[model samples]
Target: MSAPRLRRVAVLVLDGAKPLDVGIPAQVFSTRGSMPYEVRVCGAAPGLVAGGDGLSYHVAHGLEALEWAESVFVPGYRHPDRDDPPPAVVDALCAAHARGARLAAISTGAFALAATGLLDGRRATTHWHYTRALAAKYPKVRVDENVLFVDEGRMLTSAGAASGIDLCLHVLRGDLGVAASNHTARRLVAAPYRSGGQAQYVPRSLPEPVGERFAATREWALHRLDGPLTVRTLARHAAVSPRTFSRRFVEDTGYTPMQWVLRARVDLARELLERSGHSVERIAAETGLGTGANLRAHFQQILGTTPSEYRRTFAKGE
Candidate 1:
């Protein structure tokens, strides 16, 4: 039998495009040895398109690429909710979706997809700052403000610039299966398979405690994960009453003492998983979580994957 054709993926560019948003899907879908894809970077106006970073892209293909594509992607633009595309561009987007072309948007790009009326009666999202504005402007589209991304079978929207990677990975997982998606994620040094339904605004930074006294106490807790580590123990180490230490800990680091300690334990366990051939039970004991089963539960709760799965994804020379 004749082989099936490679899927044609078109990325719609526009004036004032966010460069990262444009680059994400283009880089992601171009991974080889996966479901084959032919990526096209197109613009509505068949000429120069400027990006938010003061860079210009010479787009060779016009909106006609949309008509020729099997999937269509829209990237974020400056003031995307306010700077709506020309009627012709919107019509082209709508037409592509109507013809069964899978559609996706990154960050504020969701505004462009929603403007096409294709997102009407469909759940969508944009950057957290603009989600309210997007919903107010297009009452017909269900603007879910919290998720990293939304995948309504063929239509998708992502929350922010980095979340664009998450959404693209989600689309890849659906099309190419877990193994291929994992390979691409490893190549890019990205987290594969983040829950698209999770809140988009989870903070990743845990800065060092502000004051020297609390800093030493934090370090003390770090070294004692295998020992009894109650709030009082930490307070004693800091030379303060438990109540005083708790308040200072929260003020200095924005997390409770125990929370910080738990995070440290998890971090150590994760490093062991990636760096050593240690068993999960041994790693759990080393980190003071006690057993493999306990570590598995907490690891899944925090990282959204089992310890062994994470090891497989990050192990050296894999």
Candidate 2:
């Protein structure tokens, strides 16, 4: 009947840190009775620190915060091309990594991580504007400007500010599973999932009026996930041809209709496994996965675990 220990997270705010990047993980992993995370904001040394855009931060912890953290986030800062993070900060980050703590960076924070040499020969990225500088400065790092983020297992890096949300959600999903991550995203009003491989900058075209219309279709689909749902069915509900629906749906949500439906079903199954005591067969039927055998196959392929295993790890009151 007791809950698991909270996941401790630390936000390391370097000098000239961007406000949004610093705030993203702090708020996302906030321990204010809503999530299973405990967040601490720290600086190179606890005190006043200059931030980007004329803002300043007063952190309550210093590098010592990273000592006991399970995960440490390095938020992007200004002028990464010119200024290097304090040597002590870099050393502390290295020590944290050696202690098996997960280290993630946002935007130009990748620069600090790279300086620690942990990112050497590893794929990473930063804000598109600074990708060249990152590559030039840290030639050992395989700079990838195209991706929204890179998940090199424990070492993660994301593109500019907004993608920090994507990275945090990605980490949350890995730690607690899809159900908990989706709940957090809904609370934050952020997109539930965006694959790290997704492009950081999606090319834009002229505005289309049909964008908002598909949201209704998505909501409609969520309610009928246990029923027969297909691109044709969804397109019909949206009053569009399947071809148009498929094209526009990908543009709007970065997923084909069927792909989205399958992921949604998986998410629903995860919630059911965590919160209910139903049999796998019943859960499969309820989530429209049809049979226990079929559900296990999909669970292994998508979640890398069996339904029973997932339940054992995340089920409530176990």
Candidate 3:
């Protein structure tokens, strides 16, 4: 028997939409192999769609195009301070979701989708810069500021500009398979996936001085990721009791000491995997993950892929 045909994806373009975000979903999803998607750009009106940069594009399809799509993607726009989307646009999105079409919002486009009330009580995310505004404007929606995107079943919301690509690749991976998604990423020269919970580019507030004890101890731990360092050793390095150091580290970094260490070790492992040709076992040992099996476990848990696969996909060019 033959495989099913590719799904149809409609990229809903609006007046004042950012061209880059508008193009990402269509570009990524359309490159997934012979059974590639059919991508159509549709506007709320019947003609040219004005872009964020004061340019206009001729859109051949109109709102009717969305009715036939299996999924609909709405890209970010520049003037989100204005609450009103054309009634036509809102109605089309509402109609699409009602008919069971998956709805996706890229960056500030979450504003458009949220305007429809379909995202109420559902987890979503948008650009880190506008997270507060999104939450304030749409109180019923659950906004997660840290994630690259949220896949709340029927609806999806992505973080800033580049994260749109990440969200599209994620959809491809989920709908197709890892190999298909990786192939699309290679074609686009993009990351295969960045989990939804990954931090957005929010600027960290300056850390408070947690006394000299906490400061010295974090530095000491940073230098010893390959060693068997624990909270007890960290407290000693800080010349403080373990209890004090644990509380101070959490206050300073917004994560517990062990959480910070694990993140650091994973980062170290990623660096080694990308910059060097070391086997997973060697990189695992160097990063204090102990064994390749343990490293693979953490890699899959945190990165959503095996270490070897990450290396194959993201390692320095051949």
Per-model TM against the reference: 0.63, 0.62, 0.64
Clashing pairs in 3: none
Q: Could you give candidate 1's per-residue lDDT for residues 118-147 as a string of tens digits? A: 889999988877876898999999988667
Query: Can you write out model 2's per-residue Cα lDDT over 179-237, one digit (the tens) per residue?
Result: 88898999999988653332313221112233565988988998998999989999999
Q: What's the CA RMSD for each of the models?
A: 7.5, 12.8, 6.4
Candidate 3 lDDT, 70-147, residue by residue in tens: 899999988675756888889999999999999999999999999999999999999877887899899999998777
| Model 1 / residue 77 / CA error / Å | 0.8
Query: How well does candidate 2 score on lDDT at residue 299?
Result: 73
What TM-score number comes out for model 2? 0.62
All models: lDDT?
Answer: 0.82, 0.86, 0.82
Among all candidates shown, the one with the greatest lDDT: 2
